[model samples]
Target: MSTVHKAATVSTGEDRKPDVILDYNKTKGGVDCLDQMVAAYTCKRKSNRWPMVVFSNMLDVSALNAFVLWSGINPAWNAGKTFRRRIFLEELGKALVSPLIQRRKSVPRGAASLRMLNQIRGQPSSESIPSTSTATPPTKRKRCHVCTSNRKKTSTVCPKCREYICKEHSVTITTCHKCM
Candidate 1:
């Protein structure tokens, strides 16, 4: 969540020469790209390391699904080691380059999700299951305002209000109870 942008010069493949780049170092974007590469590379690695696993996982024709379609022709083109390697390289190259070309096509995070996250961070309150007239107000659910995947696993507890927040989303400026 660091808004600090590092000005690192990287080469942009151009005919004239190299394009000097000065832009925000988006770690999230880089991580996503790396994930794709890892997935493709893992396929190749599996082929070389465990051919049987690669075959079984990829070539299960009975359950022909989206993963196989997205990943490309599964069975791994086991004509020969050289051919397989070449295909793997080619597939990897295609996988890496495709994202760059279709960069703008990525789905942007919505404002509602952000608002919900902010609400959670500011004041995390869940659905109020209605009760009888004599019943008391339901207890507020303590959960991450952002990725509401975790509830009591937060390390830093707010000093002022004692709100729990994950390390990733917790503000560095504010001192938690433990820090105090």
Candidate 2:
């Protein structure tokens, strides 16, 4: 059996409209080209809360706009799209939490400091550090080796040099001191 296909008619005259009318009107008040760009690259996941979805979408749009602006300002900064987006989001996240992390790191007077102090003492193993699960939390702040600031307690000890440091002095997310 053979199948037949109908050819589209070509309109040519003052009354004729382009076969594809490129409906910009429908898109005018809705999601624009930029929105499509952001949606294409956005990361999304299922969530129980509607607010979470809205927040995630907003974040994606912001990131997309940031990328576009940055690219416009710095032509030489071009990198692979996926890599650039990942890096941008990661850095943004770090920047947003840095202040809070610094605050928390400054007030470390609990099991965290104890762990650091134990590591600094050159103990061969965790067995050497006295485990005080039931002990009361320390009330005083410990000094940071990097800044030597007694204003804040030490958050973690540098694994490399075994020096106590506040969260601000920590190099990365792992909370290792800059000396490492």
Question: Which lDDT tens digits does candidate 2 get at residues 50-132?
Answer: 99999989888888878778778876663646577667667777989999999986674544465666678876545533444
lDDT score of model 2? 0.62
Tell me the spans in candidate 1 whose CA falls farther than 4 Å from its real position: 1-52, 55-88, 95-105, 110-142, 146-180
Best by lDDT: 2
- In the predicted model 2, the residue pairs found to clash are none
Compared with the true structure, model 2 gives a TM-score of 0.42
Candidates' C-alpha lDDT: 0.46, 0.62
